[model samples]
Target: MQEAKTILTKFNSPTRFEYIVRQASLESAEAILNLNLGGVYVDYEPRRFHVAGKQLARGVLGGVTVDNLGSSGLELQYEQELKGVVGIQRVELSADGSTIPTEAETIRKAVHGSDLILTIDRALQSQVELELSKTIQEAQAKGGIVIIQKPSTGEILAMASMVTTETGEIVSTSHNRAVTFSYEPASVLKAMTFASVINEGLGVGTSKRDIPDTVILEWENNEGNTETEIWRDEYEYETQEMSIEGILTHSSNTGTIVWAQELGQQKLYDYLRKFGFGQASGLEFPYESQGILHDLNKWDPSNLNTIALGHGISVTPIQLVSAYSAIANDGIFVAPRLVSHIVDPSGNMERLASTPSREVIAASTAHQVADLLTSVVENGTGEKASVNGYKIAAKTGTSWKYFAPEDSYEMPNGQRDPYLDINGQRHYTSTVTGFFPAQKPELSMVVIIDDPAPIEEQFYASHVAAPLFGEIAAWSLRHYQISPFKEVQLSDNNQQAFNGQTIQEGGE
Candidate 1:
């Protein structure tokens, strides 16, 4: 029996066996013998013991499993390949009722499950999660997500999400906030607005607009009564004529609205759709969201203004990041993917083709937009997101959560009025999305911090999300050894350029 156990242990299959116990003690063996002698077991089937245990993606693999099959992740998406087929065995027994080993036959061979290889870089993913966890804790944020992708191939390299529990514990959930949580993107959508303007031949050069600190617009109510509403910027700026680049750098809500108006409602809508907004990202994740791009027919005058400033419309972080990837990849929108390929038990590999690419904007237009984003990190609200040596093209977004009234407002004499205050206590979502090596981006990423507390000055993306982006980007660049700007010989007059340059910067 000991020799048999030793032989079995030596032949144990990592792909098949759940666990194997060797050199069992007499007490343990007696427990099984007692059960057998008690006649509680009708039949002792060795085949049942040989079956494989459920193998699931755990920890860093990061996929969800749900009771509803439709909502499951890769477990359901590739169930046929992952589950594999069960087999049957038949044996001819002698008159003594003992199975004859020589007469045993396998009616069907058990097919092993195919191995799914993802595009995720385990090392980079680890760093992303570590940094994201630290950032969320420092900001006392509810949760956060970070997505790193190869801009050229649209392959996701790292995706990390962390949530704070009510008990004040930070833990990782299967919920991929990057592709599932959709919210008003705030100023980050300014990049898309600018892209739309440039794609339509509207002009890359800045458009002059007189931006005011606040603007009051008159509109007819549903009851046919004239009403007025005020739209104000977060920071009061004097009314002055400024260019499109200037608007983006300053992240002016009034300026973005002006540009959206010039682009017109239908054209802007078209551009949004063209950029893959309001559609599934084709990442093949079960819970991926298409986001909320309001229908054109439902567009109100204010919708255009609000949507332009990234308020009226909502978008998943993946959607926004992929859109920026389009700009980085020279205007071609390539759908991002996770599972790269699958290797079957027979050793055959099936590589997944890249998602269909469509031209959203001209290459020249993309380059122009990339330049504008470079300016954003260098001289704009995203300055904090700048890496020491590498040029990062990024945009920052800070959006207020939409408030829903718990009950209708009562008018004079206890009469209920139709009005409900839509403005609630300020809860903000701060985000930063961009690509590095601005001239030739290899990595495009987005970081989102949801409803950060201790909101004294930490509510803004530049303060919270942008710095997180910088940290993660800096770490990723170092891990991948991504060279920053090419080394150039500094002339005597240009010696200051290399003064503070270091091979390694910005990582613990």
Candidate 2:
């Protein structure tokens, strides 16, 4: 038998090298080269790293892979750890430009990258993604984002986003919209606003005050321009006399604004900062948005009232979820985290330290806020989000989608929400966020449904996002096998205890 080989083409470039070698009469030309038959051998180059879990959380687990060339999501945050240092070598060649028959001196050995153990629960993420896609489809919505986190540690278990494109195709966007997409977060923000008031000792949970449905506000700006605007609730009604709990329970816009003013702008701004708004999420995920936070100096006359109703400001889903997580964690704000551990090439595992955390409010204050949120779910707008046997503490937000030019969420006029066109038809972003079990919470979540088809009186988050939150929360409870009938006593410990239950404490 005769065998022949030919170099059909040779190519080289700064980024790569290629040789089109053709081999005839061989079962495996590449294998033969690798076999090093006779005195010949093939010098192969090191391989580039590839990513895993592409089928699930592809956008979140993005890294250097044949599938994704650029750094994104978790890959972007842990690039250096995932991609080891390149190796270097020193070798001598003969006069003929061939390597001498001697071992090459290694100038620098390659260091393998650490393997990342993420906080994501594969099964839960899969389920959340499916449900989010289904919810968007059923609502005839533009897109949606859902996130599940361990409130105590701020570990994200599942984060998913899906969009139905203009062409009517369901697709996961190139970016992790959960961390990247920012919008007016509407009524869910009411909880945070009220939280500020309660934490500052300006008002207690049971404090009562009259809240109006509409208010004409006027103020001067840093630009020395006097602005006059009218801020109103989604519905028309007379002034409401209620306590802080009743206000949040009914999702009263005026109620929140009234208290915010009582807390004062500086304190409101300071508390919002403590809640993780307008700041990096610390995950350092690629292209994470800090959302739109206007400086206190930039506040117009109506900025407070408008923002209280979830306009004139924007927030990423991540920032919003982390804020809720703080309340769930007994007022401790734990920075959200993705990677949980790193394993070296030698198989030695090193657990990463927990993310940065600080107490943003007193435990009693957090308890009061959680109780109020629990009431929202039990008797108010978030009633639809209630799951059987679970005391879910959550709030629903329904806000119009600000239709404007690129990077233009600012409502300078602050007189009218630009979310509606000339015809009075509107686009909406609906959201529901909070934690489960109310006390001794285990999980926190935020679900946002973007631009759902506005049906009269049905565009509210109570009708859109809350139901979805309930569905997923139910499934998550079953997945984790969290006993619905758990009983733990408060330290006060007596015949009458926390939740009126007396049981032995349990630990994981």
Candidate 3:
């Protein structure tokens, strides 16, 4: 009776109410019948208001009663939100079992939630993804990744992956290779080794250990192979009397291993772990792998040599880049961050900022490391990474491997064949990691190109990853207003050159 009174007084009497009911009935009936013209009879029958569509009306409006009505959109996802009540039953049955509705509906309770606001610039992310995809595809490599982070705050500006599935579908895998996959990092570890020496007050600038610019890595004979593994010649060509700076400038494996030896296994492993090598960076990922760092007690004579050169150790790119960021941040190590904040529809903001960076070393020591790394890009293997008008500090790495159950540097016939093949020619995964505006750093990035085709065309990091670093850094520098490093005469050319202002130089 109350339902009848309410329908008569509030829903049917008013012209607008009648119109709304008519429209809803028509739409609902047609939807059920899947036809507009055939559903008029359905609306004509005088049916009792049936919340569960189980009861007939006592009488029709003007001798006509609509049988059904339904809601849409928001009412679809949460019908209870719109004061929709469960269909009640008043009668037992018609030919088909049915029930009449009699209840006042109430809306469902509202649910509270939150949203996230990220610091990643859309344009910058797009640039990095596009460039990284192009490079990896052109290389016909398995897959690759690039990550750019601000050195000061450890804010990740851009990250992209060109990961391919086992099914041959090239896609972005859920795994963040930059932070997850940890592998033996050939010569890239040299930076930390060099930094550890400087921090220990070794005074690399004036060490009097008769440090040869080149050292023949002396190893024992192979267990299976007939090849005798004696001390080979120096890995790279450089004067024996060159300074420690000269070792890193040229990315000398033997030179770096020799220096790390000075630090010794115990101290070197300590510094490596201190630099965030053997643990996760605590990023928001489930698959982050803690890289392998053998305890000093576990080190054999060979491991000491190889780990010194970054072969016996394993590390993720994030660890590697974060370690580099320590140098860029003047000895402070900031945790790498992704999401900057979260916001709701009401514009309520919940900001998520990186934790305060911890001081890993003295600022002076960091500066010393930066000074040497700067030379690496200016006149060394990373020369290809130099930006025209910016201070670029970089290191290039090409790791060699032999086909075996475990990693071994026993190159076939005393050659470091680090190249793989794609399409027809040989390829390699060349990596270049560094930061820009080296004097007052802003951005740091790592470019990794895996097993690129056209090896002769684009094999080394200088040819593959360095150029990419230059492009990304130059764009980022201009966008961020980072002051460029002025080209100064760090070395006399075959003839001569000038520093910024003075022309006083000699070489000829």
Best by lDDT: 2
Writing each residue's lDDT as its tens digit, candidate 1 over 1-508 gives 9967875665564553322343345576667557643212123212211111221112224432322122355555766677566667898866545567785688998787777888878778777877888888899989888888887788999877788899987776655677788888988988989899878877675657787878777888778988775778778767988888888887878877777778999988998898889999878676788899989998866777778788778899889888999999999999998888999999999998878889998999988888889899999899999999888999999887654444445546665432332232457789999998887788999999988884688889999999989998898888878877654455665566668543323322
In model 2, the runs with Cα more than 4 Å from the true position are 1-53, 65-70, 85-111, 220-226, 406-417, 421-425, 485-508
**lDDT value, residue 329 of candidate 1:** 94
| Candidate maximizing TM-score | 2
Q: What local distance difference test score does each model get?
A: 0.77, 0.81, 0.64
Per-residue lDDT tens digits of candidate 3, residues 374-407? 8999989888888886668888887542233233
Question: In model 1, where do residues sit more than 4 Å from their true spots?
Answer: 1-71, 91-102, 221-223, 403-424, 486-508
Candidates ranked, most accurate by lDDT first: 2, 1, 3
Q: How does residue 371 of candidate 3 score in lDDT?
A: 78
Clashing pairs in model 2, backbone N/Cα/C closer than 3 A? none
Q: How well does candidate 3 score on lDDT at residue 300?
A: 60
By TM-score, highest first, what's the ranking?
A: 2, 1, 3
Clashing pairs in 1: none
Q: In terms of TM-score, which candidate is stronger, 2 or 3?
A: 2
Which residue segments of model 3 deviate by more than 4 Å? 1-108, 164-170, 205-239, 344-346, 401-427, 485-508
> Which consecutive 10 residues in model 2 have the weakest lDDT in total?
1-10
